[model samples]
Target: MDKPKAVTAAAHKLARLICSMLTQGEAYTDQGQVCCEERYRQCVLNKLNKRAQQLGMTLVPAAPAAQAG
Candidate 1:
């Protein structure tokens, strides 16, 4: 498989692992209930962003609303 395909597959595997861990309540830290939600979000986002760039797609930030004339 190519690099892009490999990355995509790895991302999917990571997502599935995260889901399984969540379902089993094994995704929390040792501090009882400390969740790494933000870390997971960043991980997924970073992977997707990298994939998008590799695909030659520009990930533009949302545009601000224009001021009324």
Candidate 2:
């Protein structure tokens, strides 16, 4: 019943986070992209995971990359 609503809420939050990150290009290194620390990743994931849990949902884990021969 409320699943769709929950998903929508979480999606909006996640989208905003992504847009914010993308717009932070000026903050990135002049030579390349931003050098994020492990803590930053953990922080973002943790926050979104918590939000999802509150909404009775979970973020899907990314599939592993294929290996070369």
Candidate 3:
């Protein structure tokens, strides 16, 4: 939960992933920031939607605003 602990946990996970790739003779492919951010956004949305359903509510997307000339 705290910064140090979160960093350590993430480092451990990355180490394990790298080890796995090395053993499997696989190259690491970077998904890039945009892909990672989209995945995280979708994950958060899924959690929010689930909570809303539990509270007898629903989540809706806002309408796109019109472009100003």
Candidate 4:
């Protein structure tokens, strides 16, 4: 497998692990102070962005907010 493929696979695996942890309630404490959701989100996003960069893809900017009428 090539570097890109390896990176993709690793990223996917990491995402799945994070999801499992969250779903199984293994990611946070009762008081919600130890929430892992945000950390997981950032980790996945960072990995995806890194993979995109490695594949020569441009990371798009966040969409603009809509104005309420």
Q: Quick one: best TM-score, which candidate?
A: 3
Ranking by TM-score: 3, 4, 2, 1
- When summed lDDT is taken over every stretch of 10 residues in candidate 1, the lowest stretch is 27-36
Assess each prediction's global lDDT (C-alpha) against the native: 0.82, 0.80, 0.97, 0.84
Q: Top model by lDDT, which number?
A: 3
Preferred candidate (TM-score higher): 1 or 2: 2
Query: In candidate 4, which residue pairs clash?
Result: none
Clashes of each: 0, 0, 0, 0
lDDT of 1 by residue, 1-69 (tens): 999999999999889888988889786335432357767777988888999999998676689999999
TM-scores for every candidate against the unseen true structure:
0.38, 0.40, 0.77, 0.41
lDDT value, candidate 1, whole model: 0.82
Score candidate 2 by TM-score against the native. Answer: 0.40
Clash pairs (backbone) in predicted model 2: none
**Tens digits of per-residue lDDT for model 4, 19-67:** 9888897863354645678778889899999999999997787999998
Error of 3 at 66 (Å): 1.7
**Candidate 2 Cα errors over 4 Å, as ranges:** 1-36, 67-69
